[model samples]
Target: MPRMLLVTVLALLCSACSSGGDRYDPPGLREVTAANQCMEQCQRHFDSCMTSSSSVDSSDRCGAGVATQRDTRCDTIDNPDLRKRCQASADYCRNRLPALTCGENRSRCVSRCGG
Candidate 1:
């Protein structure tokens, strides 16, 4: 009976340990969905800025502002996967930003956030 009890306890202890796939996300690590949502909000802000009647900000200015906003929100993500994806998108969009309109820039900027 003591041998059986020890075996049962050992089995329970082993089961309690986490395996490779069961690992939890690190603290402050944002999920990919969160990244996507953040980018969506950034796009909305850019759209609003572009349509606003304020003459102080040009379309190019709006594009720049949204790019800043995107980086501020998405670039700071703690998750490595999300950060890598966001940076790649930002790089791709920024390179073409000078040639594209604000709306076009926004689309490219948020493209990679989606899983």
Candidate 2:
């Protein structure tokens, strides 16, 4: 009778111990989306400035503004994947700013966060 009681108590304890495992919640969906949208808008403004204005100074100022916005927004993102995407887009824009002509070739500035 004691052996049976011991077995029942052990079973109950085992079941109770296994009931409260940790649950994981994946992050970065909403924040990443918002960051990407904001970066896109900044990119468009930079592109518009590059295309319409002949002043190199103005374009440089616009590029700096875009870079600042991108960095600020991406820094707020918690997920590494999403943050990398935002940084990549910002890097592309900053790197390409000097070479941008009057044309609208922004394929290189595209954000990879959607993936």
For candidate 1, the TM-score is 0.29
Task: State which candidate has the highest lDDT.
Answer: 2
- Report clash pairs, candidate 1: none
* Candidate 1 lDDT: 0.64
Candidate No. with top TM-score: 2
Assess the local accuracy of residue 11 in candidate 2 as a C-alpha lDDT between 0 and 100: 100
Q: State the C-alpha lDDT per candidate.
A: 0.64, 0.68
RMSD of 2: 16.2
Candidate 2 C-alpha error for residue 76, in Å = 0.8
Q: Which 10-residue window of candidate 1 scores lowest in summed lDDT?
A: 53-62
Q: How many angstroms is residue 108 displaced in model 2 relative to the true structure, after the best TM-score fit?
A: 16
lDDT of 2 by residue, 1-115 (tens): 9999999999999998889778787667897787688668657866676655555544254464787788889999999999999999877765564435433444434443332
* Runs in model 2 lying further than 4 Å from the true structure: 1-64, 97-115
